[model samples]
Target: MIKTSIQSSASEIKSAREDFFYEQPGSLPGTLSIEEDAPPPVIVLIDYNETHATRKQVSTPEECIPYLDSKSVSWVDVQGLGNEDILQRLGNVFKLHPLLLEDVVNVPQRPKVEDHENQLVIIARMVIPKEHKIGFYSEQVGFVLGKNYLLTVQEEPEHDCFETVRQRIRQNKGTLRKQQADYLLYTLLDSIIDGFFPVLEDYGEVIEDLEEEVVSKPTRKTLEKIYRVRRDLLTLRRAIWPQRDAINSLIRDGSTQISESVRIYLRDCYDHAVQVLDMVETYRELAAGLMDVYLSAVSNRMNEIMKLLTVISSIFIPLTFIAGVYGMNFNTERSPWNMPELNWYWGYPLCLMAMGAIAALLVVFFWRRGWFENYSTIADDTNNKNYGSKINLLWRRSRR
Candidate 1:
């Protein structure tokens, strides 16, 4: 199931990349454009009042008509968008405006709130953290609030953060049982807003882990991860930023379906949206900083490599010069002064001794100058021992 869900999510994202699901140019208003790959609609009805509550899966939209007229609060959750006929029937049953139905069917619309006389339509985006992954599954959720009923349409059947709300309704926990449909809307919106915190926590953890990896030893893959993180944060920001305005509109605008008390609760939900936006923006800045850190790390590594190569080359230059001079083909017989040392009994040994002495002196000079401390630091770090005493003592002696 996990694999299938992941695959479907990947497909959804691919479609989003191609283009958002939109109506064709010159198309009539309220024209519905359903994706060919959308899953069939599944409607669930939950009717509850202070005294009694009932939950059941309704096969057809008409089954929900009777409950909408009751004094109790009815929540009709319609998941998936595969069947247009069913969605149309559902809209007709609820007496939804044609344009309102269009917005509900359209997947991936910007988050916004529109007051349609007695009905309050809220377009929202919900995100669920991907299982065993660093990203989240995002989908659009549309809410149509009436006098005694709230209709919610979602893009898919799975990967929603509304399960907690469902559990609350089922257990009759909190004041959800007593509240009207507007209050129920507030509760669900609050749940959706609160859901962002956990996903943001995951991102925070990822940023922490990347900080360590980027500083220690960054790689091409690290760069890719950083870019991915930035992209995802941007996606999150896009999702939550508009939501703030939408929630604000809900609070600021007048609506008969939304009561004064529910509007007050929505103020809290608006605050949560602001918090999510803050976290997203902060994460985006951190991700951008990570990119800079990755570049600096790569450059530092390159410089270290070059420094090591330069040190090796500097040591070999003198040796190469001595060897080249000795390798000359000058004849000792022709001139004693030219090659007198070539005939000495210990000439070969003396020459090797001289070369070794010169090399040792160069090494001491470079060491006292503290040029190789970085290498020592690496060694000491790995062994977890103070291996720099000798170098420090030598440095002090040379300074004296």
Candidate 2:
């Protein structure tokens, strides 16, 4: 039953691996297509100054225009892009270029940074670790920065890393209230970059567990797990690699939309992105190595099974020969020489004794060669080592 389950899981993994999504060839650029099941857009406005801060939900894009030109900073956060008409009005409200709107609503533009005449557009990918699970949720976040207002768009409202940033603004925490729109952009971007750490930490723990499983008791499920981890890390790498360059471009290009002080902060964000990329690459390599280890462990297990079968066959070979000789029908009534053993009363007992003696001798020979002892000892050692490490981990966690 266990073997059947393992085979079933292996087949599922193979099927999943063969299924991949790709863009249609020769697709038009700046396409603004939306998913049919996408949720309606949710608009939120946060206007703040050094002395006061206010947050409210806006129903229409034009409602945000009154606060956009104020001396204080305005953050217009749009949570969905289900309605094309609303998104178009939002583009007009912010004076955003058509291509910029397309990029924001397109759901998954690669992470990038573009500087327009008076605005800077940033496309970033954000990841949130799933609750009570071993995977992550990923989405694209687009930012459009203007003189006194900053606009941000997210594909969905269910999962976002910007809650803390919102809280800081609401509570007037730290110097966030005093800084300009550029500073708000930095805070949000920093939050997005830092979010990768927790997700990566989850992957790190999973990899450690898989490492132990692959070494001590690898199964088809273990191979599937390794492949899944590698695939996720690849996705994360794809999201972060272009983001790092986008940040570096923001710093190096010297966009007037981003202040010098904010650029310094962006440099720090760049370092965090680099660290994330490093960890992802390391995990990917480790996952690949774990796959090799799993294959080798399975091969060794098969060899051990074959060795035991061969030993059993070797012990039975002489016993089978002895039985064949005694059971031969060579005309015992006509020729005494051919039927001497068949006519003797003690012949049957002697033949049985001979076969038993031969079996015992072979068993003793195999024992002396240490095959059985070696196999048992190796299994015991592996189990003991795995248990010891698990116990140590529990002890450390308890201490913490």
Candidate 3:
């Protein structure tokens, strides 16, 4: 039974290690594919300068053209990529290159940065922890930055991690209004990088809880939780690892679109990415360690069960032998050589008393050998503190 359980756990871990998503093999470059059920695109424009800021929902791609070339910094946010016609029109409005449009449309491209002659393209993944939940919502966010305007594309419009940045911009809480389009880009990227912390905190809390569960009462559910935590951490690592490199490239590579000041801010964002990756790796290692501890705990529990059964069977062996001997019919009336005790009046009671004495002596012998003491403490303080009651119950049963 224990062997079967261990094998099942091993298989589950193996299955959980599979990749989340992958591009179709041999697919052509610059191929645009959209999900059949994807929502239509919605365009929102936020144009701001140092003194004033205005936000409007643009119904058409051409509606954003007047603000795109103005002295004020313009932000064109297009949420959703379901409509190819609208997306192509958007590419025309922003003068986006064909390859860049393809990257923006692809739902799960790897995080990267591409510097064009007049624009900087950034592909980033953003994750937001679900409200009052254990998992996260992940989406791809694309950016196209020109001289005085920034174009942002998102896979979906339902959830985003940019609300705080939006609030800061609306309230004019900081120098966001004073900075250029690059600064706005930095602020959004910083928010996306900061978003990882909350999700990591959630995973950290889960790992701590699983540590206790794995040691004390590791059921199939506990094993599932451990595997899930590891899988989520793996997903996080994939998302953040390339993002760190992208930020590093933004810092090191000379891009005219990103100012020196913005590069300095990008350095800070890079640090946060690195920190998030470190936490992910740490949590993954801890989760793996917990799996090992769980297996060992289960094995120990099985050994204790087998040991108790062995002791019980050993005590019964001599009693069974005595009963068998007494049950054998003896011809005491025909020959004196046969068992004489069978004719004795006290034979039946003596046999019963001897069997009882033998059984008691075996129990005492086992007790003296410290078998009971060892059984009582099979679940140690560090490993199975929550199992004390179970151990006590088993001890009482063995005594009876």
User: Candidate 3 residues 115-201, lDDT tens each?
Assistant: 999999999999999988899988999999999999999988998988887787789888999999999999999888878877887
On residues 174-247, what C-alpha lDDT tens digit does candidate 1 reach at each position?
Answer: 89988999998988898888778778877877887787778777988987687677767767877888889999
Q: What is residue 388's positional error in candidate 2, in angstroms?
A: 16
lDDT minimum window of 10 residues, candidate 3: 386-395
Q: Please list the C-alpha lDDT of all candidates, in the order they appear.
A: 0.81, 0.83, 0.83
lDDT score for candidate 2 against the true structure: 0.83
Q: Regarding TM-score, does 2 or 3 come out ahead?
A: 3
Off by more than 4 A, model 3: 1-28, 374-400
TM-scores for every predicted model: 0.87, 0.86, 0.87
Candidate 2 clashing pairs? none
Sorting all predicted structures by TM-score, with the top scorer first, yields 3, 1, 2
Model 1 segments more than 4 A misplaced = 1-21, 375-400
Task: Report the number of the highest-TM-score candidate.
Answer: 3
